[model samples]
Target chain A: TQLLEQSPQFLSIQEGENLTVYCNSSSVFSSLQWYRQEPGEGPVLLVTVVTGGEVKKLKRLTFQFGDARKDSSLHITAAQPGDTGLYLCAGVSLGNQGGKLIFGQGTELSVKP
Target chain B: IAGITQAPTSQILAAGRRMTLRCTQDMRHNAMYWYRQDLGLGLRLIHYSNTAGTTGKGEVPDGYSVSRANTDDFPLTLASAVPSQTSVYFCASKASAGYSYNEQFFGPGTRLTVL
Candidate 1:
């Protein structure tokens, strides 16, 4: 059984401040995906990182996959009130078929105006 | 495109009752999945269908069953609902046409409570 551990389950930051969320695991993965979910809604994909040590950016968000493929991180720049929501990290195990995904506990970010 | 839609936005039923959650997708994706989201457990896959006439078990499939008789729908069934089964259910679908699988598109989710 593979498990992904996410740090700082809860975060409250003021608008304009930068913050980072981390996801760590001992098992290697073929790909990692970040998702943002607002209240009462299912999660929506933010980014997908497939290579070790690779980084991808989406507007004010940056995502990085660890060299070992066992860790990943999400960094938000100049956070805004609209960014408040739950952030989730999901990893796809190597050689797994049908695109199965393993998810982390999630980070609840509350960006205050 | 109504990417995906789930029936009965919210349901509350007495323990031991049978319940079936309906999920329909419009994208004609080859893969469909069912998951349950708990307060701290994140999303745990209950079942998945790679395509029509094929289904597989996921991490938490102890008390649930799923069927995929066609390409557009996957339904999850609980023979006898238990309180512990109360959680938000999400259905997701993605196309599988190339080497890399696509990110899943999720439905709004259905909230179920068994008392």
Candidate 2:
């Protein structure tokens, strides 16, 4: 069973449009991370949020950790074709000491030029 | 420096055959993990090692096995390959706890097919 759930599994929009993806879980987490994966390549970490109610920004991408530590969201502004890829969210359980990370299904995004 | 490397970028194996996927990291990370990615299941952990000489099972560890002999290498072996074992496998490593906030460096990946 999947511990985390992601919304809008597949998304497609024209360039310059903005989009947001959500990741939710019933369990609390110590840290949550967002990764962008290109075709045939491993996932690359985009951002990591540790504290609840924290917001981080990387260029035009904004990431927010829910105040309850049970959810997170990723927002990309002025989406470009280069932003097209698979977005994944992973969370570290509070009880995880060995660094086990639980992952969500993933959101495949496509930005049309 | 090469963060991580995986062998046999892609392979085709027959059922009941034994195969092993190799992963090595030069970062000397204390933790290593093996994950498999499928269509809708995303990435599922198979096994992990917190440090050399220690290994533990992850969410999905049925037909797979792993061993960490040293700080640099972790190999995952499939004693009996099955069609269900077909998937893209990834190897990842991270700095010890308290040093890194769950950011994992992943290898390119290995695509395996069991017939």
TM-score, one value per model: 0.97, 0.97
lDDT (Cα, tens digit) per residue for candidate 2, span A1-113: 43989988999999999999999999999899999999999999999999999999999999999999999999999999999999999998887777688999999999999
Per-candidate fnat, comma-separated: 0.49, 0.60
**Residue B66 displacement (Å), model 1:** 0.6
What lDDT would each prediction earn against the true structure?
0.92, 0.93
Can you write out model 2's per-residue Cα lDDT over B28-108, one digit (the tens) per residue?
A: 789999999999888999998888999999999999999988999999999999999999999999977344376899999
Per-candidate DockQ values are 0.61, 0.67
Q: What's model 2's TM-score? A: 0.97
DockQ of 2: 0.67
Q: Candidate 2 regions off by >4 Å?
A: B97-100
Please provide, for model 1 over A33-74, each residue's C-alpha lDDT reduced to its tens digit, 9 standing for 90 to 100.
999999999999999999999999999999999999999999
In model 1, the clashing pairs are none
DockQ-based CAPRI category assigned to the predicted complex of candidate 2: medium
- Here, model 1's chain A TM-score works out at 0.97
